[model samples]
Target: MKEADRCCGSAGSFSIIHHDLSMKVLERKISNIVTAKAEVVATSCPTCTMQLSYGLKSHGLTGQVMHPVQLLAKSY
Candidate 1:
């Protein structure tokens, strides 16, 4: 999570409009996640959740990606 504040490259329809560039940005974000060895990735944005989930799967990594609220709910 080194660049936890960085965008996941799914800003609204930006990913769809600029697929290639979006993937590049997502790759960087995913790289940081991998480096952190995160077991779960939490994000408030639905787009980021989707992108992160896809990125993990694409990398053949089985990490959970969820909304912060969903994770909090699971903690109970």
Candidate 2:
């Protein structure tokens, strides 16, 4: 969560249209997740959830990504 405010580079179709650049940006986000030792990453953006999930798998990390609402629902 080091750069929680930073963009995951998904930006809707950005990741698919600019795969290389998107991956580069996603790498930074993934690094922060690793540094934070996150087991799950929660975000409200659907694109971010998909991007983060892909990033985690590509990095060989076993973390899960979910929407913030999903996390809140799980707490009930």
Q: Please report the candidate that would top lDDT against the real structure.
A: 1
Q: Model 1, range 9-49, lDDT digits (tens) per residue?
A: 99989999999999999999989999999999999998998
Worst 10 residues of 1 by lDDT: 1-10
Query: How does each model score on lDDT?
Result: 0.93, 0.92
The numbered model that scores best in TM-score is 1
lDDT (10s digit) by residue, model 2, range 1-76: 7988999989999888998999999999999999999999999888998899999999899999988888899989
lDDT of 2 at 43: 93
* TM-score of decoy 1: 0.95
Lowest summed lDDT across 10 adjacent residues in model 2 is found at 66-75
RMSD of 1: 0.8
Clashing pairs in 2: none
